[model samples]
Target chain A: MEIITSNQNSRVKLWTSLQTAKGRQQSGSYLLDGWHLVQEALNQAAPIQAVIATEAQMDEHLADVPQGVPAFQVTDEVARHIAKTNNPQGIFAQTSLPNNSFDSKYVHAGQWLLLDRIQDPGNVGTLVRTADAAGFTGVALSVGSADPFGPKVVRAMQGSQFHLKVIKDVDLATWIDDLEENNYDVYGTTLSDTSVDYKTVVPEKSFALILGNEGQGLDPELLAKTSANLHINFLGKAESLNVAVAGGILMFALN
Target chain B: MEIITSNQNSRVKLWTSLQTAKGRQQSGSYLLDGWHLVQEALNQAAPIQAVIATEAQMDEHLADVPQGVPAFQVTDEVARHIAKTNNPQGIFAQTSLPNNSFDSKYVHAGQWLLLDRIQDPGNVGTLVRTADAAGFTGVALSVGSADPFGPKVVRAMQGSQFHLKVIKDVDLATWIDDLEENNYDVYGTTLSDTSVDYKTVVPEKSFALILGNEGQGLDPELLAKTSANLHINFLGKAESLNVAVAGGILMFALN
Candidate 1:
């Protein structure tokens, strides 16, 4: 049993870096905070680097930690320093990033969600969670979208990443072309002259839905590549729906 | 035009207090930050107590500010102090809360959203915005839910409060009975043995949807009083959906 009290520990500094994309790129591991995420990752058999907790949390959850996994007890101050939330849960795990990258070479035949430059972390995370709930096979994030493994987005995802494949940094136009090659019907959500009502599209097993940014709707190039552009009419005066909510309603409607 | 440079000025202090529930309770007004929100309130003819902006912002948007309304030109430091966001938009309005209260004697005939103690400000605001977009007549916030006029929620709402009725501190139980008296179907969203699938509900002109808290679903007592408790089935293994996303899907489906 190892107990660390200083916030300046080398291991603590390394763990803090997992919150950023550059840090994650350097280490190939990201932090998972709170008991539920840690439990979910353990259950899903994702590669685990380490388990950490405050003394109180360790005493309660130690038995559940798998055999041979490195475990440490840290002071509450150190726990607070490493955790993102104001009130730290005191239990966390560091896990290897899953290798679920997709490209133009091969496109799987299933319900896929492609996010296009959706910058808000909350929207990105909620869309991923909603995709999982709506029975999507995977979610693909484009280059300018929020970091898929970023802390805020991961917290918003609420363990759904472990349940579904989340491929980061996807080039959506090429991916759309690959899906066409695989006989997949690709749909873009934008209100354009060529777009049809979202409900008009019948659900097929192998179709992908592309959601655009909060401010900018789908890029014209991406919309041109899609099989059909779908629009969910806002029945009331709101200028537009939040991208995640729009994605949720569309995913469920099309699925 | 009054110019305020010090953060400790009485007017700045008063404006800052609007971020809290108690302050709003006493003052009967809340702050609206950013150009879009202020412009929306002005366009909607919402009663404005005052407008404040930095000198640069004042120059850009002064013509849009309604006549006879008090305006202040504040320093950038004061604007940052009074505004909630890190990068203050510099333009703001202090407006009187709308008078749209309802009781057993009278209930409106249209779709309504009753939030049952949903705590997250982001969730509450997103739900309200979604309800507005889904053509809801109004939204009612229960006593324990996040403050309807709180800064974070209002920012999340993105001026949707001006488009529809938003009543705060509502007693949901009594309100449900009142809605029933008005020939409205009140639906409670909870996943339980007796709850029916949300899709089973037929859309009608008048109905109220009650969404529960994030972790705890609907209160059992509240569930018993609902015309029919509705549930949205999650097809995948994510366990559940975000309350706002679930509400958005159900609202559009049943609208």
Candidate 2:
């Protein structure tokens, strides 16, 4: 274990890079902040590149870092700068992005959450966690969806990312084609009168439930090709729901 | 239309006071940040006492300020000091403290969201917005719940606050007592076996649906008195949901 105290340190730059979408994509790393998330990442046997802690924070919390793991104690100012949070909890970890390639051969013949362009980090994370809890097969993060590995999304998932097969950067059309080949049913969420109640849409052997963004609903192109559209009836004045929450309820219902 | 350049000004101290629970309670005012929220507040005819803007932000966005509303321009540093967010849209408003009193005489019977100690600001805001969209009569904020007017909550609500009756600081027992007096059926969310499937619960004419905290869940004392204890049946491996998301699903179902 070595202590790096300077702002110019290469490791500090690496951790800071994970804060941006571009930086994260380039480095193939995402920043996991605070003690709890870092610990959870460690428990899941997630890929760990390095850990950064402030001297005071290290003394208070990270005194028991395992022998082989690389740990660094940096100046408080440098730690704050790298973590991007006023209170960093004195621990930040750089975790390598998992190979998100899905094994089509192992695709579960059950309910799945297909997210399309859900931009809110919290919403995406909540939906992923709910999908996992509702027993949906791994989440398929389609193009334009917020990065699940991003800091805000990670917190919203509450560590469920480790327990689920979170696939990212997929072509929805191609994914749908693959599912059709594998005999999977597809259901898209919509607010149309013709749509069936989400409750009535019984889960089949293999199925994919598509949820669109909050404001736009499902992409029209994607909606046209789905097996059928499902709607959650609203007796209240609200015309619709937050996409992630809607997705969660549908997954719970269908699952 | 007074420009507040001094951070020590009484109005500035009052605006900044909203950052803490004690300050919010002592003075019946809270802060609203960002353009969307401030705009929504304006549209809702919410009491807007003062507006703080930087010269740059004002020139770009402040054309719509009503004729009578008091507006002020501050340096970027001072604006940043008063703003809750680092990358503020450069607009901040002082909204009068929302009346926390529920008009019992106005109780006519409809769906109501009784939040039990949901302490997270984001969760509180999301629940408020969801409840409003679901067409609930009002949202009853319980004792341990986060301040509904907090900046994070205001941001999350997306202007849903103005659409519903937001009563805070009431005695939960007495509030429930009043609801029961008005013949409202009470239901509380719980993880216990005694809880029934939320989907199965019918939306009666007048009912109170209670939600619990993020971690420990509904208080046993409150759960014991409810007419029914309900739970979202899970077919997956995950346990429970984010409070706000769960509240959304239950509210949608019950509504």
Candidate 3:
């Protein structure tokens, strides 16, 4: 086991840089830390460019490593420095994004969640995890949504990213238009009397449920275009719910 | 504005110590930060002992302060130190636990959420916020649940603590008995086959819903005591939604 003792190591620096959106895009790589997230990437056969771990964290998981994959042993402090959270499970890997695309052709056959400009990474990640659990085929992240590769989002997704298709930087208008043209009903969460109760809206064979930012919901232009604008009726005093939680409830109800 | 410049000031140290649970409990105080939360506390007439702020934050909401309350002015760094999030709005407060006690007297009214060992503060706080929004009358935190006053929970709730009636450290068995005695039906979130769809369960005119931890759904003791066990059918690939989200969905649906 070769130990990389220096914090200035090129690999460590590169791994740290993946934390930022610009770095990830520039290098075409992102960091997957902790044993669980890394394992998820491996299970999906996500391209692994580099692996860094302390000896204590490596053990049995390294058995499946492919030939020529760069692996390094580093001190706990060095691992912590590269981790987004204070508690790193002493593992981190740099992996290329999946070579996947969301096609309008399949949008009419399954459930999908469309996230519009949700700035909170944790909320976005939780929504992705919930969408996966609710049988959504994939999540389409429109412009203004939090970066999927952001550390907070990754942690919230809790390993669901490996199995789910996360398409970012797409135009919501065009995406919804394509889906609607193919007979997909798009439901957006809103708080209006005109909106149908989420529970009453039966699950469709093909639908796109759009969730918006925590502060400002879906834009008026997009809301007007939605096939069905839905709202969860709250009998209580709360004005609304956490967007991720609201999305989860709608997903469960629709499913 | 009399600024407390010394780190050794008894009040300053006490505020700083609230960053951890042990410190919060030892001093019998919890730190509530941000203008909205402080204002919410004021609105509820919560047991706010001391209010601290930086110049900018003070200027914004100082007029809302009631007469005779001790309001302290501290350095920006001091305010930030006591604040739960790294990004503080520059307002911080120390509040004592309310005099309200958890007993049968408070159980006979409207909907209430009973948490059994839900350890994550964020989940608990989010549930509290949702419960408040859903119009629940109060919340009873069973043993093993996370401290509601913890920083993570406070941030997640977004100032809901002020609006909701909260009672912690109660025995679940005794609490259930009292609720039943008071003619309140108990509904618990479970994955059991006998559990009905949450939407189908018409909430009793007066009932208490029990939500458990993210991993552990509910305590077996509570489950056995519940008049009805309910489950949100997860039709998707994911096994479950985050407990906080699930609780929010169920609370709104039941109401």
Candidate 4:
């Protein structure tokens, strides 16, 4: 085990960079903090590049760490500096970014959720987790969406990213064309007259569900490309459902 | 219009106090920020105790504020102090806290959502908003749940609180008993043997759905008293669904 005492250590600098989207993109890795996330990474056999823990956390959860993984011990102060939350859990793992590219054949035959620039990290993460729970084959994130590897998204996903295929930085417009060419039915969410009630349609075995940005519903250009747009009918005064919650209802009900 | 420049102004001090739960309870009011929320308050004809805004905001949204309401113009610095978010919208209103007490008769006849100590303000607020979308009659908050009037919760609810009845500090256990005595079907969410698939159950016209806390789900004693307990079955590795997402699925499906 290596001991890191200084926040200025080169390794610490690399770990700190994982906190931001640009840094994660440049480094090709992200940080996972807390016991649950670290444990999930180990169980899923994710490519954990390194593990860092405070002495106390190392003492408590050392055995749970995968054998042969590089481990580092840091002081409480260093751990706090590396953590983003007010109350740091003291255990963290740096895992290589998973390949976010998938073949069109896989998209053709699997259940996919395509996100269009969903901005909130929590919302993005929750949708990923919900997609996982609904047994989605994969998630395709459009370019403008929040980084799936951001700290808040990682926390909210609870390691579901390791369990499911997550493809990012895709041109959803082109993806819709490719999906259509493969004979896959694409459903976009919207509230227009052309849209059918989500409950009335029966989902095929393999299909794509498109969710839009938080403030705006699906773009009209995207909506025009779908087999049929759908809406969740409700009676109350809320202008719209929280994106994640709406995604969950659609995923669970349609799946 | 009254102009107040000092952060130490007695009115400013009182408004700042509304940031905390104790302060809100003690003062019998809470703060609502942003044009959307303030406008909703006015539209609902809620009791607006005071309205405060930066000079610019007051000019832009002046026509929306009730004509007879007391208004204060504060400098940007004072507006920032009273605002909870970094990007303060510079418009705020102090509104009377709604009476949380409801006649037992209303509980007996209407569709209800009982939240059991759900701690996350976002989750609490989202659930309230979801309940509104599903056209639930009201929401009852158990003792341990985050304060519904908290700023973060208010922001997430997106003015839904003004559109529906949100009864706080409710004892869910006794509320369940009262609901049962009135022949209401109290369905609790759980994953045990006694619980059936949520998809299989037909919701009655007037029923209660009990959602539990984030980390730990519904308390066992409360679950025991439910007419039936239900679970949403899925194939993913996630141990559970997000509380708000779960509540949304249940509310939308069952209703």
DockQ: which candidate is best? 4
Model 2 chain B weakest lDDT span, ten residues long: B99-108
Q: Give the per-residue lDDT digits (tens) of candidate 3, residues B85-195.
A: 467888877888654465765566888889989998878888988998788888889878998888888878787777778888888888888888889888888876578
Q: Tell me the tens digit of each residue's lDDT in model 2 across B124-179.
A: 88787788777887888877788888778877777777778888765667666777
Q: What is the per-residue lDDT of model 1 for residues A1-255, given as tens digits with 9 covering 90 to 100?
A: 889998789899889899889889888999999999999999988889899999999989999998988998998888888895678999999999888554645765668999999999999999999999888889998889999799999898988999888998888888988888888989888865357988677966589999998888888899989988898877777878788888989988888
> Which of 1 and 2 is ahead in TM-score?
1
Q: Per-residue lDDT tens digits of candidate 4, residues B38-93?
A: 99999999999899999999999888876889999999999999995567989999
Which candidate achieves the best lDDT against the true structure? 4
Q: What is the DockQ of candidate 1?
A: 0.81
Each candidate's fnat = 0.82, 0.59, 0.75, 0.82
Residues B1-255, candidate 1: write the lDDT tens digits. Answer: 999999889989889999888888788899999999999899889999999999999999999887898999999888888886679989999999787566644776778999989999999999989998898889998889998889989888988998888987888889998898888889998766367988677856589999998999888788889888888877887878889899989999998
**lDDT tens digits, residue span A64-125, model 3:** 66667778888888888898556788988899966546565556677788888999887998
lDDT of 2: 0.79
Interface RMSD for candidate 1 relative to the native interface: 0.9
TM-score leaderboard ranking = 4, 1, 3, 2
Question: Looking at the true structure's interface, with contacts defined as alpha carbon pairs within 8 Å between chains A and B, what fraction does model 1 recover?
Answer: 0.82
CAPRI rating of model 4: high
Distance from true location, Cα of A143 in model 4, Å: 0.9
Candidates 1 and 3 compared: the better one by DockQ is 1
Stretches of candidate 2 above 4 Å error? A54-67, A103-108, B1-100, B103-108, B149-155, B158-163, B181-183, B191-205, B219-221, B233-240
Model 4 residue A114 lDDT score: 96
